[model samples]
Target: MERDAVIVAGFGYRRGASASSLHAALALAQAGHAQVTALAAPGDKIALLARVAETLGLPLFAVPLSALGATTTSTQSPASLAARGTGSVAEAAALAAAGAGARLLAVRHISPDRMATCAIAEGPDR
Candidate 1:
């Protein structure tokens, strides 16, 4: 892993999802990938993501709803589109929090329980 690289892991989870669910999703998305420097999620989900960030010893970025809705994602989900006006919550959050010129390392990954999703993004500077 490049220590200087800025890699962000974004997550989206259903209400009542356990911390393990988010961790599982993140682990799946991060397998064989660079180390995650940060975590992000929609503003409404920030509190939930913050717990994971704290456990991982990483900062958490709270992406605005408008920004999340505006971001384009590699994977499209009808449920996410209808609820958040984005294709994928995890992907949108990752890109939005990664700042301008960010790109996804891969498509979003879901937890085994199917209650959470995660996506990784790297900033342009990386």
Candidate 2:
């Protein structure tokens, strides 16, 4: 496998998202392109993104979701959510390291207001 990167963003469960972003993500995933998710997305969004990755057998690079700006009811990260309430954060991290057939990394995003949230915005493996 050549191993490509994928980023999905601008996902709003209640508000919805731009057609372009979704289309672009799907196209990129289908074409096997590297990506970095840099949107004001939430934790549930990350979980959904992970499910998409699992379905397509594609590795997803996603942000470390938090409750600071989220409006949903989730209190867990994607890794924790994926483990189905059976693994700790450390174990999940270990699994990500060992069984992670794909690479995922966290990158900092510069806001328009020049503020830093130290968020785990998704990025490509490139």
Candidate 3:
């Protein structure tokens, strides 16, 4: 059987980000988009991201800092750059976790509280 294409949602957030913050950011990123197949974030943030993944029943990917640095993103945030060495942590995480040949479907979207950010990417058949 042919494998299905995958859509990955990646996140970046403050230290105290709550599940609500993540869900809000995800909602914005998911607007007018297909359902996400997985979730991703920096390895350090994986613990925080786990709640959202568990709620959504999706797999989560812990992208390494090296991989995040290697991926290019559409948006640039000074905070993200200074802290993570990436233009946009949400975008970089999405691209990195989406695997080779993955392309972004949506740029980063911040939560209403500005405590979290999310981006979406679509990858080749899994």
Q: Clash number for every model?
A: 0, 0, 0
| Number of the top-ranking candidate, with lDDT as the measure | 3
Best by TM-score: 3
Worst 10 residues of 3 by lDDT: 1-10
lDDT for model 2: 0.33
Checking candidate 1 for backbone clashes, the offending pairs are: none
The segments of candidate 3 whose C-alpha lies over 4 angstroms from its true place after superposition are: none
Model 3 lDDT on a 0 to 1 scale: 0.94
Q: Which stretches of candidate 1 lie over 4 Å from their true place?
A: 1-3
Each model's Cα RMSD: 2.4, 11.5, 0.8
Give per-residue CA lDDT, model 1, range 1-126, as digits (tens): 454657999888899899999999999999989998999999988887888899989999999999988899999999999999999999999998888989899679999999999999998543
Candidates sorted by TM-score, best first = 3, 1, 2
Q: In model 3, how large is the Cα lDDT of residue 88?
A: 95
